[model samples]
Target: MLKYYNELLYFAQKLVGDKEKAKDIIQETYSKVLETQNKREIKNQRAYLYKVAKNVAVDEAIQNQKLQTAVYEESEHLTQKHEQPEEIAIKQNQEELFMQIVNKLPKRAREAFILYTIDEYSRKEIGKIMDITSNAVEKLIKRATLKIEEELAKKGF
Candidate 1:
């Protein structure tokens, strides 16, 4: 174990992306290996140690990912109204410009684009809502996007 200390540390560090966490994983792996009841039946001690290290590292990574996801969700829940004034202003400007371009679209194209983009409607759902076929929804959305792109280009956007 002493011979493989640095090597195991390097392996765990590579797997976990953190030195302190890797060290803890290696220590736990060593403890688990030392407590094994069938030590004599092991064919290769070094290989067994590496396998244990990998398992511990994988478990640690999974736990860390769950913890990070939970923390992110909690923070998002706690900060529902945390938008900065500058960000709000920029978003409003972009939304206003998008609405201006969208209003200039042909009536059917405008409806399709709004349903698809702003309302987050699927093409089939837009078809149901717009009383048109799904293929027509696709074509209208595509034409609206192209017209918006051309308008933005004309405005040096």
Candidate 2:
């Protein structure tokens, strides 16, 4: 189990894209595996550990998505008294345009850009999460930025 710790952590990180969350998932996986082991005889511990980690990560992702949706819906009902209607509409339009531009990016480039800009992850951290070199992460981010800039320029903003 100790020998597989590093391997499982890397696997979980790739699945979830967050180091601390991956560690928590791995811990939960070990706990669940141990509880199951006590109940029955197990032949393949390594495979079992990976399967458990995958399942836990998937479950967490689903839960997070649901929570985010609920929060977004709730926030929609809470109006900001300070912002005028024009200001609110402009902000929403800007956000929508930015999202449209980001969606046009290639998958890897978009992920790198979002991790760096939106999620506030450093290039080194993004590289580790994406399993790429820091240089590769930089290139991806640059490509994404260039595409976004071009799109925004065309829109006269």
Candidate 3:
């Protein structure tokens, strides 16, 4: 159980994408799993623990999202240092172009792709993090992959 804690922490971090939030979520998950185990008819302990942890993670994410405020103040401050609106406009244009390309990807495929390609995660590692099979990760990456020729053709990556 203690050994699995490290893996659990890893999954929570990847799922939450924030170290501090992941720590809180994992701690809550451990407490809940222990308390539930003590009071319940023990069935599949491992699955039960995973299910409990997953639920806690989901709840935490939803709760955090509801309170989130998307702010561009920091970006605006940086733009002041850029000395010109052209620089700011260029930055905005680049961001828009990148997102346009990303939006073309399938949902799970894009998630797996960004995690694996952009973040340099392994298929096995991403599988555990995304709660999917390794083969599924591979397929998602393959499906989302753009050939160099195709990217060049569309002027997108």
Best by lDDT: 2
Write the number of the candidate with greater TM-score, choosing between 1 and 2. Answer: 2
Per-residue alpha-carbon lDDT of model 1 for 46-153, expressed as tens digits?
A: 656777887897687677676566456647654333253223434565667777999999999999999899989999999998899999999999999999999878
* Model 3 local distance difference test score: 0.68
Per-residue CA lDDT of candidate 3, range 89-124, in tens?
445555666666667777788899889978999999
Residue lDDT tens for model 2, 1-157:
6677897899788767789999999999999999999999754566677778978987897778755654566477655643533244456667788999999899999999999999999999999999999999999999999999999897768
How many clashes in each structure? 0, 0, 0
Kindly indicate the candidate among 1 and 2 with the higher lDDT.
2
What local distance difference test score does each model get?
0.78, 0.83, 0.68
Per-residue error (Å), model 1, residue 18? 47
Candidate 3 collision pairs: none
**Model 3: residues >4 Å from true position, as ranges?**
66-157
Please give the distance, in angstroms, between residue 102's alpha carbon in candidate 3 and its true position after superposition. Answer: 49
Question: Largest TM-score belongs to which candidate?
Answer: 2
